[model samples]
Target: MKPKVIGKCIIEKEEFPDGRIRIKRTTEGITAFELYWHLEQAQEEISKQLMGLLKPDIIKRR
Candidate 1:
């Protein structure tokens, strides 16, 4: 479910029978170096596996 779009950020949530994916995104504001840092260390499937193995609150802390 997409709650709303504020400025460059889109706050949304995705739910499934067993789990979900909550995401916060921004189309602008970050610098190029920040983008590179995120892209370099990000895990694309970590969310899916995380939902399978852990809980949302754990992710919220990181």
Candidate 2:
């Protein structure tokens, strides 16, 4: 299935035939395309970036 927005992040889930499941979560942020439409006839290139708020949290799955 395709990823969908759940809360702040985009989440996707997949199930394997071997009884294993895969889950992924990605940050939903602004894209470069959005800048073009809003800016309209911009001078130079525009970009948006995201940075970690704090220390990264590592998750270990069994």
Candidate 3:
């Protein structure tokens, strides 16, 4: 089963356009990092990171 999303942390680069990293937290206490370079990238990365939080092994690999 997939975990529920609980929170997020986003970091934006002041000097670079579309440069950002986002970290999402799940109800299961898992977190995943995302790298973004554009609007699509930001959306895609958040989705990818949230999916990563669903796997039990993802935390161990960090």
Candidate 4:
């Protein structure tokens, strides 16, 4: 399948007081990364083979 851009997205950059920088991409209120994750999972489901597994503790590490 070919990939397509379905909608508009927003990119944001932030600087912390400690001189740290963070960049994020979002669409509608959902972060683009998370949105892509859900889309990828859905695609895997349709293929009947979800190999892109993440550990249950992955969030804690992040």
In order, what lDDT does every prediction score? Answer: 0.63, 0.55, 0.56, 0.72
Model 3 off-target regions past 4 Å? 1-37, 57-62
Over the full model, what C-alpha lDDT does candidate 3 score relative to the true structure? 0.56
Q: Which ten residues in a row have the lowest lDDT in candidate 2?
A: 46-55
Clashing pairs in 1: none
lDDT of 2 by residue, 19-60 (tens): 999999787655556655557644333322112322243222
- Taking the tens digit of each residue's C-alpha lDDT, what string does model 3 give over 1-62? 55443356454434445676555533332323212235568789899998987787777789
> What would the per-residue lDDT of candidate 1 be over residues 21-62, giving only the tens digit for each residue?
667654545665667667766665667677777777777789
Please list the residue runs of candidate 2 whose C-alpha ends up more than 4 Å from where it truly belongs after superposition. Answer: 1-7, 30-62
Please give the clash total of every predicted structure, in order: 0, 0, 0, 0
Evaluated at residue 22, the lDDT of candidate 2 is: 97
Provide TM-scores for the models: 0.25, 0.34, 0.28, 0.34
How do all the candidates rank in terms of lDDT, highest first?
4, 1, 3, 2
- Residues 1-62, model 4: lDDT tens digits: 44455567889999999999999988654555667999999987966643334543565588
- What is candidate 2's CA lDDT for residue 57? 35
lDDT of 4 at 11: 91
1 versus 4: better TM-score goes to:
4
